[model samples]
Target: MTTSSGSSSHVTDARGPLHTGPGDQHIYYGDIRASASSDRSGRDPRQVAVEELRALRRRFVDPVGSDRARELLEDKRAVMLTAGRGHGARTAAKVFLCQLPQGSRRFRELVDQAEEGDSAGRALDREQVERGAALLLDLSTVSSRRYETFMAELPWFLKVVRECDAWLAVVLPALWRAGFEHVFRGLVVRLERPDPAAVLQAHLRDVGIHVRRAEVAVPELEHELTTATMAQTADLSEDIRAARENAPPGSGFAAWLKTALAARAPGAQDVEAHLSGLDSGAQRALLLTTALLHGARTDTVHEAAARLARAAELPEVATPLLHHRTLTARLAEIKAAAHRGRVRFTVAGYDAGVRRWFWDNYPQLRGPLADWLRTAPGFTALERADRLELVTRFAHERLRTGPPDGLAALAERWSGPSASPEELTMAARALGEGVVHARYGSHFRQQLYRWAQDTALPGHRAHVVIGVCSEVLSRRFPDQAMIRLRHVSRHREQGVRVTAREALARITDSDDRLYRSLLKRLAPGEEPRGLRDLGIFLHVADPARMAGDATVGALLADHWTAALAHLPPRRWEQPLRAWLERAHTRPVARRPALRALATACARQRAAFGAVYAAACSWAAGDPARRRTVNALWEAAGSVPRPQPSRTAAAAR
Candidate 1:
C-alpha cells in the first residue's frame, strides 16, 4: 500500500492519430488476445489502490472541520478544503473521496490546468468527468495566476460534475483562502489542525501497538507532538515500530519510545559526527554503500563498497587486503553492525540520515554515486531483492536531492543496448520510483512521454518503458499510461509494438470509457496513416470484447463510419470477418454489431456498398456461412437510418 504523487495534468480530449506503420498488418487478432489474457492474469491496479486506501483509513484521525467537509461533499457533491501546510490536507482529501461508495465508479485525482499541456487554458474536459466518479483536484501547488484561471472555470467544471452525478474534493492553498473566499462562500470548508497525539495514537494502533492514553501523554512526547505535523507523527509511529522490532528481547514500550524519539532528533549533526570519525575514502564509501543497501549480506555490501570506491576514483591504500582493517572493524567505525550475515545501522533511522548527509553535503559526488549504482547492483552474490532494494534506495535519495534528469539519465544508461538483466531491472525500478515520487512524478511522466516517442529507442529501453507504463503508471495515472502506450505501440520494433498494443487492448477492454476514448483517438480521417490506425482499431475492436450497450454501439457506429469511408476493404476485412463471426456465435452481440455496421453504411453509401461486397464474397461458398451472412445483412438493413438535419448539411 503505497501513496502516489500529486500534480499530474489532466488528459486532453484532443483526438490524435494512432499510426502503426506498414508492418502493422502483421499484428494479428490472436496476438492481441494472447497479450490481453496475459495482462489480466497479472495483478489488478484498482485492487492495490483500494487496499492502500484502506490502510490509510486505519490511521486517519478526523480533523476539526472534517464533519462539515463531509456534509458539504455529501449535500453539494463538491467541497473546497482549506488548511495550512502540514495539516494532512492531502490525506484528508483522499479519505473523503474514498468514503464514497465505489460501485463501478473510479476514484481519480484530476490534473489541474497548471500541469495540463496545451489544454491548460481550457476548463476541465467534460468527457473526463465520468458519472459517479470520486475526484480530487489538488490546487495546493499551483501559481496564483493558474489558480485564478481555475477559479474562472469552476462554474463550468462544477456544471459538468453535477451533470455527471460525481463527487469532487479540492484541497486549496490556505494563503489564497481570503482572496477567493467571496467567490466560493458556501463551497469552502476551513479545516483546523487535528490533535497530533491522536494521530500518533491512531498510527501506533494501526501498527498493532496498544497502550493507555496516559502512557503516551508524557511531557517530552507532548512537546514534540505540539510541534510535529501529522506526517511527522505518522513517521514517529513507524520509527517506534522499527525500534520495537530491533530492540533486544524483553525490551518494553518505554525503551522503544525513547529510542524512536532519539532517532527523530536532528540527524544531520549525528551523521556529520559519524563521518568526521571515518579516516579514509574506503571507509566513507563503505558507509555510503551500507546506507544504500542497508540490509544486504555483509559480503555483498563489501563488494558493492569496493565497486563504489573504484567508480568514484577513491585512492586505495597500498596495504594488502589481509593487512588492512577487517570488515568487522570498518563496520564498527561506521556505527553499523552485521548480524546473521546481514548488515544494518545500529540506529533505527541512521541509514537514511547518512544517505541524506552525503547527498546534501557533497553534491560533486552525485554523478559518481549514480554511476556506481548503475553497476553495483549486479554483484553475483546479491540476490534479486537486494539488487532491486539498492536501486530503490538510490532512486529515493537522488530524486529527493536533485532534479529528475540525473535519475532519468541513469535509467537510459542502464537500459542501453548492452544492458544486462540486472541492469534492466535496475532501470525499471529507478523509473518506477520516479513515477511514484510525490514531487517529481510529473517530471518522470514527461520523460516517459519523450522516450515513448523516440523512434530509435532501443528494444530494451522500450521494454522497460512499456512495463512501467502498464504496471506502474497505469495504477495511478491510467490516462497518461494509455497515451504513452499508444505512442510505444507505433515503435519500429515489431515485438515492442505488439506488447504495447496488448497493454492498450487489456486496459480498454476492462474500461468502456477508455475504449471509447481509444476509438476517438484512432478515428480515421484525412490522415495518411489510415492503414495503420485501422489495423490497431480492428485489433482492439473485437465484438466479443465489448459490451452490447447502446453507448458502445454508438461509438462503434461512428468510428466504423469514418474507418469505412477512409480505409480500403483489405485493411479491415479480417476484423470485419471476426466481428461477423462473433455475431454469428453470440446471440447478445448479434443485433448491436449488425446495427452498428448498418448505421455506418447508412451514413456512407460507399461504406454500405463495400460491406455488401465483402458479405457477398464471404457468403460465396459454404451454405452455413451464407445463411449467417444473409441473416445478418437483412437484419442490418431493417434497422432505422438516421436522417441528416438541414443544419448539419449546411455546416458540412
Candidate 2:
C-alpha cells in the first residue's frame, strides 16, 4: 500500500529479481497462472469495504482485547453476503480500517451510508450477495478469514441452514446439536482456540448427527412426514410421532372432539352426515377433505368419490332441477337423435342408469334408452364395465353348458302346494346330488340351507334364484320371484336328511363344498340344525332324537273348546308346553291343578298367570313355598312372579 516509505511500509517492487522479468511485473510467488478477475482498481468501492477492514482487524488485532473488532467483522460479513461485487474492493477495504480520531461524525456517517447504500442495492450487488450468503453459518467453517467475516453478517442465518443443503456437512451439525446456541456460547472462544475441525466434531457429537470423527461423508435421510409436519427437518417423523402421542392430557386430539361438540358440530352422531346430506357432489367433496384433516379415514374420502360417481349416473341428479322432466317431453328429439345415431346425445342430461331402468321396466324409456345408448357418454364408460362383468358372465355361461346346480332340491323350495311328499323328497334329493359337483360358494350354500329350512307352498310367491349365462355374477345369479313364501311346516318334522346344519355334522363339516352349495339354495331366516341333532340322527338315530310331544298341563280356552273336545286330552300338550317354556324345562309343571285338579280337570291357574308363572305361583300358594317365594320377592324389589296356587286362592 505504501508508494515510497521504504523503511516501514514499502511497495518498491521488492520481489527478489528472479532474473529481472521483462516488465515491472514478475510472478510474485511463481504462481501466475491467471490474474484474479476481482483485481481491484480505483472504482467507488461498495459498503463491503467495511467487511474487508473488519476481517483485517480480526487477523491483526490482539485476541484478548478484540470485541469491537469481531463485531465489525460480523457486520462486514453480512454486507459482502447481502451486497454485490464492485471495483476498489481491496483499497476501499483498506481505507475502511484506517484509524480515525474519536468524536468524529464523518466516520459514523460513512458506516451508516455504506449500510444504507448496500440496503438500497447501490453497493452490494444482488448476485454477489447470494454467492456470499453461501458461507453463512452459526459455527465456524473452513473458509478464509475474509469469507468468515462475510458469513457473520446475515440476520436470520439459520434460514440458509434449511434451504441450503450443501452446507449441512458443517452447519447442520451445529444447528442440530445446540439449536444455534453455539454462536452465543462460543462467543468468547476465539476461532484459533478450538478451530473449525474441532468445532465441527464437537457440534456433531452434541447434535447426535452420527458423524465419524474424521470422515467427511454426508448423509441424506428420507422425509417420512408431509410438509405440514416438517418445521425445518426432512427426517422428523419420529419427532412428529412423539408430539402426537404425548399431547397434553385433556388438550390434544381427544379434546378436539369436545371443541367440535361445543361448536355444535353438524351431525355429532354421524360424522358423514354433512357429506351425505349434500345434494351437490362438489360440496360433499369439500366437506370430505375437511374431515380428513380433522382425522377422517381414507375410506371416507373414497366413499365420497363413489357417492359422486353413482349420483352422476342418476337422471334425477344429473339433470338440472328445472330440466328434470325434459327427457319425457323431448320424445321426438329422442327419435331424431336415434335416426342420426345420436340417441344417446338426446339423453345426455339424464342419468344413463335411470334411463335404462325405465326402459327395462316401463317400456316407455326404451325409446329414450336406445337413443341415448347410441350417443351418450354412458357407452363410453361402459367399456370399463366390461372387465368387471366378464367373470360373472363366464360363470353363468358355464352353468348353462351343464345342468343347473342343486336343481332338484331347489325345485322343492319353489314347488306348489299340490306337490306331494314323494315328489318333494325326490326333487330335494336330485337337487342335493346335482350340487355335489357344482362350484357353489359358501355364502350361496348358507343361503340354500336357509331355504331348505323353509317350506314353499303353492299359490304363494316364493322367490327363487336363477343363474344367467349372460351378465356377470351380480346379474347372473339373479334372485327370481317377487316374493319367497316361507311356510314353517315343511321343516317342522325331523327326518333322515334335512337342511345343511341338520345334516350329518362331521360329514358336512369336512365337505365344505356341499355345505356351501346347500347354503346358497337355502332362504334367509331358516337355519340349519346343529351338529348335535345331526350327529344323533346319523350316528345314533336314538328314539329320543325322533321324539316329539312334550308334556304340559292341559288348558282349553273356551274359543277352541269344540276342537279340543275331539282330542284325547294330550293332542296339544306337547308343542304348546314346549313353546310356553321355550321347550326349556323337561315337563311343564302341573300347577298343582289349582286344588289338585279335583274340582275342574283344567288349567285353572291359567286365569292368573302363564304356565311357569302360574305353576310357580301355585307353588307359592302353599305356606311352605311362600317362604321361599317371599324371600326371593323381597330380594328383587318389585320383581314379578306368578304362583298358580296363590292365584287360585286369590281368585277364590
Model 1 per-residue lDDT tens digits across residues 1-652: 1111121112212221233323443323222222211133455443444566777778889999999999988988999998988898888988888877752225777764323344346536675686677888877866677677778777778878988888888888867645553547798888899888888889899989986788789888998898788888898999899999989999988898999888877489988987898879999999998998899998899998999899889886788767988899899988899999999988767888888899899898998888787676467489866777777777778877658899888888888888776677777778877886666776778788888877669877887887777767776677777778777776777777767776676655444455555665664454634444555666676554344344456667766776787777886676677667666666666667777788777877767767877876766787877777777678667766664211111000
| lDDT, candidates in the order shown | 0.72, 0.25
> Per-residue lDDT of 369-407 in model 2, one digit per residue for the tens?
222212211222222222112212222332333334333
Candidate 2 stretches greater than 4 Å from native: 1-401, 405-417, 434-438, 441-456, 459-613, 616-652
TM-score of each: 0.79, 0.17
Candidate 2 has what TM-score?
0.17
| Distance from true location, Cα of 295 in model 2, Å | 71
Global CA lDDT computed for model 2: 0.25
